[model samples]
Target: MIRVAILISGSGSNMLRLVEDMTGDHPARPVLVASNEPAAGGLAKAAALGIATLAVDHRDFPRDRPGFEAALLRPLLDTRPDIICLAGFMRILTPGFVDRFAGRMLNIHPSLLPKYPGLDTHARAIAAGDTEAGATVHLVTSELDSGPILGQARVPVLKDDTPQSLAARVLTQEHRLYPAVLRRFSAGDKTPVMLGSEGLVRGS
Candidate 1:
């Protein structure tokens, strides 16, 4: 079985979905859930789900990214995960830290990607009069949200949509897209999975 470690920085709705899906015939199992904030709510949730949890609080390093990552690496090295999932993990890892895991790390972004690569994606898409907004699961590279795409799930941008409204709908797609990508990815398949507003379309 593939040993997976999830990193989160907030409520971890995506993390929960990922964890819940790794069961029965799933090829991967969660080994740890670590966070940058000690008080992150996801830690409690992961613990409730019987997953080991850790907090390598970023504040302790005080403007030191490498130091923070070094501290974060201790538990991760001890756990020796085969895959790392960044589920809402807010920290921007340094190139050295990113290189440590390299292709084994994955992240789910809240936009179709190759489009809005960073924050405020829903708002940006709405402002630009986009007809569709969605999510992408991709390999985590040194660049911010610029990794090779693993899967994409698109949702319609409604006429009456606000950022919050569009985000809510897109989040539903994220919950589906990330797990689907992880399942295929852990099984050694890199073919991109695509989902439309309806459901699974085709691997493109």
Candidate 2:
């Protein structure tokens, strides 16, 4: 069985979906859910679903980046997760911390990655006059959102689409793509699966 540990910083809708997907006829299971914020609503949701939860408040650490990342490592090490899923986790992890997990970590980004790799992706896409925008599930590397892409779901950007409207559409795609990618990862495959202009493509 693939044991998973999830990290979240806000409402855990994506975490909930991952838990549900893993529990259904699959060997993957979420053993722990950790949050950097004590007030994160995902902690409660994880509790309700009978998943073990931990709150490692990032603010309690010293202001130095290394000290803060060291604090974050404790729960993750304790859980001994086979895979770590970053579900709306807000903090930018240190490179050392990211390397510790390496391919074992995954993150779902808001925009079809390699495009808008940072914050305000939806608004930025609209401003740039992009005709298509979506979400990506990728392996976590030391670089920010530059990891090997695992899966993606694209939505055409309509001329009438506002940032908020486009975001709503992309978020729905995220909820679907993230869980699918998790299942694929748990199955011991590292290949990339993507939806491109030519339909679904799997890359070595």
Candidate 3:
């Protein structure tokens, strides 16, 4: 089975979903759940599930991105992960760091991508009168959120939807989409996965 290391910054809701999915016949097993915040709630959650957890606090390095990444790499390299999943990992990695993992790393963004690349995706979509909003799981590249998409799950934007409500619905799709994409990706399949808001079923 392929080994997966998940990086997180907060609660790690996506990490939980990914870990839970990696069982029985799944191609990948979660080896580590590491975070940039020492007090991240996900650390406790992961440990509770009998998964190895780590913390490499970015605050310790101050303005030193390389130093932070270097410190982070020590434990990560020890895990020898075959695949790395950035599950709500908030830090923006440097090119040198991203290039090291390149094709082996994956991330789930809060937007459909090529539209809202950075933060505030839900608000942006709603403000623009968009009828749909969703999440995208993609290969990690040096550029921010611009990598090739491996999967996407879309939800409708209701007329009365606020960013928070819209975000809540999209988050559910993310929970389903990320794991499905990772399953295919870990097995060396790069074909895109399209999902709808109703369930994990494929979308047109």
- Which candidate comes out best when scored by lDDT? 3
Model 1 collision count: 0
Pull out the clashing pairs in model 1: none
Q: What overall lDDT goes with each candidate model?
A: 0.93, 0.86, 0.94
**Per-residue CA lDDT of candidate 1, range 106-164, in tens?**
99999989899889999999999999989999999989999999999999999999999
Please provide, for model 2 over 1-204, each residue's C-alpha lDDT reduced to its tens digit, 9 standing for 90 to 100: 889999999999889888889976776999999998999999999998889998888888767778877776876688789899999999899888898888889999999889999899989999999989988998889889999888888888889998899998888777777887888789987666665433344352
Cα deviation of 32 in candidate 2 (Å)?
Answer: 0.7
- Ranking 2 against 3 by TM-score, winner: 3
For model 1 the local lDDT of residue 130 reads: 97
- Per-prediction TM-score: 0.98, 0.92, 0.97
Candidate 1 Cα errors over 4 Å, as ranges: none
Sequence-dependent TM-score of model 2: 0.92
Error of 1 at 179 (Å): 0.7
| Evaluation by lDDT, superior candidate among 1 and 3 | 3
**Candidate 3, 18-113: lDDT as tens digits:** 999999999999999999999999999999999999999999999999999999999998999999999999999999989999899999999999
> Mind sharing the TM-score for model 3?
0.97
